[model samples]
Target: MTRKTTNSLEEVHESVAIVQNTSIWKKILAFFGPAYMVSVGYMDPGNWATDIAGGSQFGYKLIWVLLMSNIMALLLQSLSARLGIVRQRDLAQASRDTYSRPVNMVLYLLAEIAIAACDLAEVLGMAIGLQLLFDIPLLWGVSITMLDTFLLLFLLNKGIRKMEAFIIALIAIIGLSFLIEMFLAKPDVTEIARGLIPSIPDSTALYIAIGIIGATVMPHNLYLHSSLVQTRKFDRSKKGIKQAIRYNFLDSFLALNMAFFVNAAILILAAAAFYKNGMHEVAEIQDAHRLLEPLLGTHWASILFAVALIAAGQSSTITGTLAGQIVMEGYLNLRIQPWVRRIITRLIAIVPALVAIIYFGEAATGKLLLLSQVILSLQLGFAIIPLIHFVSDKTKMQGFAIGKWTKIASWLIALIIVTLNAKLVFDEIETWVTTSENPIYIWLFVVPIAIFAAFLLLYIIIKPFVEKNRTIPNLVPHINEIVVSESNEPIVYSKIAIALDFSKTDQKSIASALQLGGKTAHYTIIHVVETVGAMVHGNETHDYETTSDHYYLEEYQKALEARGYQVSSILDFGSPKKSIAKVVNENDFDILVLGAHGHNWFKDLLLGTTVDAVRHKITIPLLVVKDH
Candidate 1:
């Protein structure tokens, strides 16, 4: 039996058309947007705080960290894109297939938390930007950020390309804003060069450096990038996969470096405008924004800072929401409306942000933002480790698996992230234990959770090595051996029912029905009026729509009869699914043939597809034919 592989990002999978025979540059253009989507996560509002903190406290000392993080991001993201392109699975979907149900639940939960943490930072960043630029109250600004959830829905409704265009535009604003800021707050070149050389001056610097790395190499971006790359329609053949992997590598390199420039510029701007002026404690985004104009002797400095902050926060929002949808669907094999999924994630992030702002005051946002980054860091290992294992597996990746050197490099990067994140987590838990008023709560709550997480992490790592031949669930079709035989017996349907939408697909449906039942068998052509009067009055309705639809049915019947085929027509009123199912079941048609509408998941979900509903309601075999 033939089965269709369910593509990730079902609505937009292979949505962007790539001209395979085009010039290399043209092909590159088609593969460009996914990486941009991933890159925005690197320079999001979470990174801004860390970058600002690093630059203000240590001057140009941590620029190397940003550079290192960007390199790591590009490497891991390339692997992610490769997985999506070659294996046709996102990180989450891949994880679901590898791990059992309970384990997948744990993995899915962690991913959701990481995304929520990331979104929390975005919400606070957006609120802070509004507070800085428009003097809007922080509370009101955060509430205002909720409205953009709908805005994102609107942009996505347009298309992935449109969404990508929106993100690119925001990224441009961020890049341009910082470019001007860099000019205004000219720093010592010699100092920046020194920062290129790695050195953690002190423990405080080390902490900030880890924060920079954590904020830059986001966990959710891995899930987002892997799924996003599948948006481009590319050839799945060896040559096409090679081209996709190559172009995506270039995409990650350029886009992430632009993120590096944005982040490094943030650090450099803070160094020049604050660190040089002895304002080493300017760690908060608001503090950085407040001091920018005075320190640089220009109001545009502060204005651009706020503008960039807003852009970063807003752009990151779109990807975070998308990641939430990806993880939930990929891990659970459960799909929901994108808007509902997005709002649910946004609300999850919003509640905590609102609580922190309302209770702890607006000043607490910076600490909350840092805490969110830490949560993301804690989840990083889980995402990265699985991705490396999946992409490294020869059986899964086939010819596209990483080479020895690339595999070694990928593991080394994973080791670095895991080590740093472990340290970050330990340091944080220690701090909480030492400083909290109720230290017993840390041991009772945080420590056990940490131990549980550690064990869970260990399980995923060791399972692959121990159980080498564990079967992957049939989540997608693969080339493998199966029992096959040829049957000599001929089969035929005595009676066939064809459902028509009266569009171009009606011809296809009629043809499919004829093929199924043949010229000798009975055929019933079905069409539902579905007019307002028809829905209200059913067969009692008398209107132009009903009369016209009846005539169309007669024409179809007469044409089939002239072709020397046994054909009849049914024109019913009210709902299509119910009417068609009733007609098919009541008449005991041997087979039901209908034209496939070929709508994406979103449309089928929101508007409802007739084929699915009818299939469930009817007892007859359904053959859905696609329109050519």
Candidate 2:
């Protein structure tokens, strides 16, 4: 059966496999990659800033916030993973399918802001790491990170498994770096227990606590985890889906708990090394890096810390780029090339960090990082509300949803996130009013904007269930002219070349081409075998793309021959796009006809739509028959 149109990387859907009769360990192993990809977000440089800030200021008192946020992350991420598994849609694609255009546009904007906010954190972290490690100037370090877009493109072209492995390796480096430093820092056991007792300590401490939560349970993580879980191939049977969800939860729990340790380790290390000695303002990464060696009396402490910082920054940004593509494609229904998308995101993130370093100086970036987290925290409701709404609805999820208590618990987490983030904003405004020289000027700009943001958030939360979305089909043909063709019609072309990806069970293009070419026309149906993930890793799949294409081509050949037309089916493996072009160029063909699946107008442009790619490579005349 053809999978439903979800436009969110359907090309890569079920690309990874799970052995049917494998032992539980092997099954769980198969589900392990997505969460590791997700876990990279949790222990990013943003976590370091908040955790260190909290630790240095309140002496581990905000550990409770970190712990609480992790629990919330575990629940929400579980919901997201389940949403993808069951609905067969990521948050973006799912939202687009169900919401009104205006609502979806607003969400798309919020998602863009959230991605940018998250990227800013990652970029600044990378720059700080560079400063610490190579003694590079912060300005240059920030500028240098723009090139990582190319690195992300390389890893992406390598395939998902290599990408996951790369992220895991970075996580290990960060973990090992901290593990070594944690021992040297020698944190107190009793104070840590007291910190876990759930007291806010003070309002200022509460501000940092909110940041800790934001850093731990990122908004983008919720979206990213949901999308990532669908990559694995599994039985679509009820029992099989249930099993996949169970293993996926296990994967998220174990990986996020590991993230918990790294984030906690950051705070604990900062608390032990700095706070006890009265260094409260050691919030920036470089500041902490400078103090680590002197405070711990170990030569390697700062070095490991810097190396880990670099690793965390780099790893987090790689996934951040992927998350951007997912959100854009899922919502806008168009995906730019991996490298182009990354450059766009990385550029938006880099400019701010670069300015913060050069104009405001390195010390000011600590505030920028905190502001980024707060912005992330503010946008959490926009993401969390829809995620919870989609998964909780019986219409959307049917039988495969969280139970009543789990739903209540998920809402409670959302409520807590909303309340805490609101308080953080309110408290910041209060502080600014009390402390700033130009309070009136700031308020003039901030209050209305804040009100607008809150109103929008409230509307988004309620709009989905409250309003009946005006349903619009994905395509509306402009039918200004009509033509009828008979069997006696003149032959349009002597020979035709048709390239198909078998994205759908589409026969409209073939019929149209046949009618245009008349019964005497000869056609070549071509399929190409791509080196999907086998470029870097040997663990490529059952050659599903090629096999599926061959099966579809056989059916096409049979149908064509039965209609009294001569047809040949060709399957060429390796570099499928190039192969399509080579065949078209080498052969004497009057016209190349390609079946185009209409998504948005820009879908072909962004998605590397097979037709768009093959069209450029061949000088032959082309007709793009559309099936939306």
Task: Say which candidate scores most in lDDT.
Answer: 1
- Check candidate 1 and list the clashing pairs: none
RMSD of each: 10.2, 4.9
Residue pairs with clashing backbones, model 2: none
Candidate 2 per-residue C-alpha lDDT over 467-504 given as tens digits, one digit per residue, 9 for 90 to 100:
54435353312111111232666887989887765544
**Deviation of model 1 at 375, angstroms:** 1.6
Query: Could you tell me how far off, in angstroms, the CA of residue 444 lies in candidate 1 after the best superposition?
Result: 2.4
**TM-scores for every candidate against the unseen true structure:** 0.79, 0.84
Error of 2 at 374 (Å): 1.2
> What is the Cα-based lDDT of residue 562 in candidate 1?
67
